[model samples]
Target: MTAPAARSLVLDAQALSLLLRNDRQMITRIEAARRTGVPVLVSALTIVEAVYGKTDTARLHWVLSRLQVQEVTPADSITAVRLLHDAGDLHGHKYAIDALVAAMALRSPPPVLVLTSDRDDWRKLCGDRMQVKDV
Candidate 1:
């Protein structure tokens, strides 16, 4: 028999970007991962990052409706700020948003895993404290 899914999966900005761009490899992998009941999660931050302007918004909404989305609230933002602190200086940009996302990946008894293509900035912030994969 096929092996059961042994991991959780959360989509970061890049993963959504890949899906938006219709990258065959990324789509295939994401599809298989979803088909197998992987606990996929996406943050509002990732959604905003993926959607971009007007045109992409429709597509983003359509995609989001079909996927599993986890909302990042004010409290989540606050906590993320503390966790993301000292990682780097978060200016007027999406730092708080990212922090909330990082927090989502660090949830309760069984935390969700993160799927990202960005191996530089955000990953450095969270590190091994988060179960993030480059896939």
Candidate 2:
């Protein structure tokens, strides 16, 4: 038979923050994806970045209501650490959250699209494993 359809879209912190801020483009993209029955995913690390401050509790809740939050599992954490190490040693960059986001996106099935504002880092970390949609 045919292979299973690819899964959801992953949102990085910047993209999620844009959605929280009600950016028209991001909202429109999310709405269009929802219309096509594709759910949006946000890594736990991304949530940490987006809701670091005490303000915007209501806004955080609203954003959460619109997307699925994927928790960082032990395996994901290990992979993230490895990614950080590799990038730091090779590219002179140490980005924990971005690595975690990449790990989460890579865990998903093929054809996964990651909505991100920082395209370069994600591109370096993910390579050709997933598609990065710059926002």
Candidate 3:
């Protein structure tokens, strides 16, 4: 018998906020991933966007405890800059944090899934490289 394929989940800012707000759907997906031993990831930029200007330390701690936070490496930063430039050319604007998240998702192992509220932006950024679930 073959083992199930390894899977990982990347959460965007809106998805993280929904999870913090105790949204049933996001909670269900996150808990299901946890049960299946799938690593739940949050980009550093997403963390910034999710928790910025928040005064609730306890809630922030709780949210932070739920997922693995991934930092942008030097390589990721370079790629993100390029992605931002490309997005600016393509969409007439830049989504810096989204580009960073997409870059991180691109480098993750196969079968990666992204939970995002901005489906169109992520789809454009990721370019069919990963599965995107709308939150």
> Per-prediction TM-score, please?
0.75, 0.84, 0.85
Return the clash pairs for model 1, or none. Answer: none
Ranking, TM-score, top scorer first: 3, 2, 1
Off by over 4 Å in 2: 1-6, 52-55, 85-94
Off by over 4 Å in 1: 1-6, 54-58, 86-94, 108-111
Query: Candidate 3 on 1-135: residue-level lDDT in tens?
Result: 743354889999999988877889989999998998899999888877876565377887887898898988888877877776666544333477788788898888777888898998887776767888788
lDDT of each: 0.69, 0.79, 0.81
lDDT of 1 at 85: 72
Model 1's TM-score against the true structure:
0.75
Global local distance difference test of model 1: 0.69
Ranking 1 against 2 by lDDT, winner: 2
Q: What is the lDDT of residue 117 in candidate 1?
A: 68
Q: By TM-score, is 1 or 3 better?
A: 3
Model 1 agreement with the true structure over 1-135: per-residue lDDT tens digits: 643344667788888787777778877877886787776678777777776654366766777776778887777776787766767665456566667777776662244566676655567567666565685
Model 2 lDDT per residue over 1-135, tens place: 743444778898888888888889999989887888887899877887876565378988888988888988889978987876666643333477788778888787667888888888877777767777799
What are the candidates' C-alpha RMSDs?
3.9, 3.8, 3.5
- Candidate 1 vs 3: which has more lDDT: 3
